[model samples]
Target: EVKGDGRAEDAYLLATPYNRRVAERLAGAELRLDEPPPPAAATALPNIFALYEENIGAITPLIADELKDAEERYPPQWIEAAFREAVSLNKRSWRYIHSILRRWEAEGPDYEEAGRDPEADWLERRYARGKRGAGRLR
Candidate 1:
């Protein structure tokens, strides 16, 4: 019987000895597993700047294309600075830098003026508080 979750509660009800015979005949065909096992390097590894640079170098063309129209949309210096920061901090968090770049591209002129929005502001505040608390404990 099929359940609300789309699973057959009594799957054995549909299975029979005859099903085994049919399966045996088809078993001779190469049956690749639907899902492959996880890669050997599935676990998180130490972040290395060299490895990060290699990946960034491979995607440089895409980054260049994204910045091609930046001069027309934003101040040249601000755009250059953002790109420089993104490259310099690539090893720290490329995804975060990519998100910032996307926001900058979408916001256009307002992007540079925003100056590290609420999320960054909150992080800075929290970090400052932590430092103050550590000093008090010392």
Candidate 2:
């Protein structure tokens, strides 16, 4: 049964065999699935750990260490994008995601088919160049 606050307590979760397993997993994760993601520039995306668990698999110790290392080096949005790109490519491993992020960092993101308008980009660059040139004496 749920509490008056409509929240399920450990007692309720532990009462069921399946829910007991879920409770144990949650305890191991140290993160609540119901809690909002930590504040970041991109708040719309799901929490990184939850997203990984849902899309990939349970976060083993080695994987958790890798995630922490990646978090230190990459922005949350880059991580999210890498995950998306991996899933799109049907390569759902963290290694694939890491490689995507590394490639983006070293070579820049490939904007082709990423919902960008090449004409608009060219125009923007042209406008910027015009502004810069206007300030110089020809």
Candidate 2 structure quality by residue, lDDT tens digits, 53-116? 9789999999998888888888777888778766765677888788878998898866445686
Q: Pick the candidate with the highest TM-score.
A: 2
Model 1 lDDT tens row, 1-138 = 223333323323336789776656554444334447767975543232333354454446554555454435555444444545555544334455455556766775343555645446545776776865563322
Cand. 1 TM to true fold = 0.27
**TM-score per candidate, in order?**
0.27, 0.49
Q: Which lDDT values do the candidates have, in the order given? A: 0.49, 0.71
